[model samples]
Target: MIGFHFSNYDPRQSGKSKFDQLLDLFTQLLTYTSGDVTEALQWLNELDKKYELTDDEYGMGDFIDELKEKGYITDDEQRGEIKITPKTEQSIRKRSLEEIFGKLKKTKTGDHQTYKPGLGDEVSPDTRPFQFGDMLEQIDFTESIRNAQINHGLDSFTMQEDDLQIRETDFKSQTSTVLMIDISHSMILYGEDRITPAKKVAMALSELITTKYPKDTLDIVVFGNDAWPVEIKDLPYLQVGPYHTNTVAGLELAMDILRRRKNPNKQIFMITDGKPTCLKIGKRYYKNSFGLDRKVTSR
Candidate 1:
């Protein structure tokens, strides 16, 4: 008989190479540094010094060279600048997608089905007598045949319109979503890094919509003293500013974006840590960061 053995697992013994491990940390640091490759690398170097991340055989220089050779970053000798490439941007998004949604159990691919029955691909269990306008494909032949047998004896063997049964299918709907991220000074306050997680969530959500639900639409809006749209590719470079939280502006922009979408299902997802402290009126701004202003909340 064959026997199996088990032993304690060591992370160092893990299959991932040094380059891959450093790349993961490097990508995460890039998000915090607003996609600045040089800054991210500098942070990585500092981390390596403290944590002994590299050994003599494989080091930071080797990791950097591999990054360039793998097309994740581009070097400009004249400007002496290192920048992340589009491939890196997409890689960050994919990594974020896995980090956020990896825990979810796998399921069949399909759109959200509504309770209301109509023409759809997913068949429902509910059935009713066939209507005049119902499509021929909607007819449940098994149920219809049973109905016919009950209505007419086997000797007679007659089928009628009254014996037909229609199986209703649930309606599947596509959604248009606007994600609003607050990039105010408050987000990075108290030595906590909130903006990085927000960027990760936005990137993950955008990737999920574009890849898994192609029919659905996603729009990203970043709000500071003002609100504006940002492309998916620009998410990694988003930064918070010395601005007050303008929740009203974010909502208005989100609604404006949703209006342009033809999909019937529309929604807004806002991520903010603080209350509304500012509002834009006419050409000026009304700001009261001390606390929640009644004037701002009323609006």
Candidate 2:
């Protein structure tokens, strides 16, 4: 739980401070709840009473009304509930990702590669003989004029093969990568929680793939003793398990998921703090607390 501080202003107008107070309250609430404005306000009323709120003070109802008026939340009368607005949702996600991930690189993966001058793979932008539907701007004016004079006489003008110039497109393929994370107990060893940062990276990479490359694939995976996929909504509350690392299991699952894709270029990204210490054998468990088991490594 997070607490707030108030300046020693006159108590007569203390209710005015409710806006600032509510903002902090909501920020804290967002950490616990998934920015559920209505749910948070409902719980806030109890907190207000616990603090012995004054009658003149802005209550949860008033705060919720203001939130609607300000467009932070919207009330769906038919649904009889207040939900987060798109603006608020984006803000929360951006803030959370920034706080956890700090800054991350924009990754790209596609046929079109970003070209920089002097790079070894420098693509030739020179034009070739023009084809039908080629842009008129690409015409070699000098060559075209010379051809027109020689072919159709100087007074009459007509385009010919020598006048044509066609722009060339560069080609370079890249692999689309999907990163998987293991949210098992070892990640937060001795009370060092790592899930928050992991979630941030996933969100960052997802955003990067969608915005920067557009064609890239980024899938997030979290595994404990057993592995499974999850959505962005399932991230914040993700907790580590009292289970062993299952790196091979996670990789096998990832490979299975990526196999069906038609993309010739594809790869897997696995981030784990510890080695795979366990493997499922029949109905029993094979455990190796020792460092880097060969069988697990081979898998």
Best by TM-score: 1
How many clashing residue pairs are found in candidate 1?
A: 0
**Candidate 2 TM-score to native:** 0.61
TM-score against native, each model: 0.85, 0.61
Model 1 scores a C-alpha lDDT of 0.92
lDDT, candidate 1, 1-299, per-residue tens: 69988897544677888988898999999999999999999999998998888999998999999999999999888999999999999999999999999898878756777888988989899999988899999999999999999999788988899999999999877899999999999899999999999999999999988898888888999998999999999999999999999999999999999988888899999888879999999999999988778999999
The backbone clash count of each candidate, in order, is 0, 0
lDDT of every predicted structure (CA atoms): 0.92, 0.65
Query: Candidate 2, residues 86-124: lDDT per residue as tens digits?
Result: 666554555555655555567643444544322223334
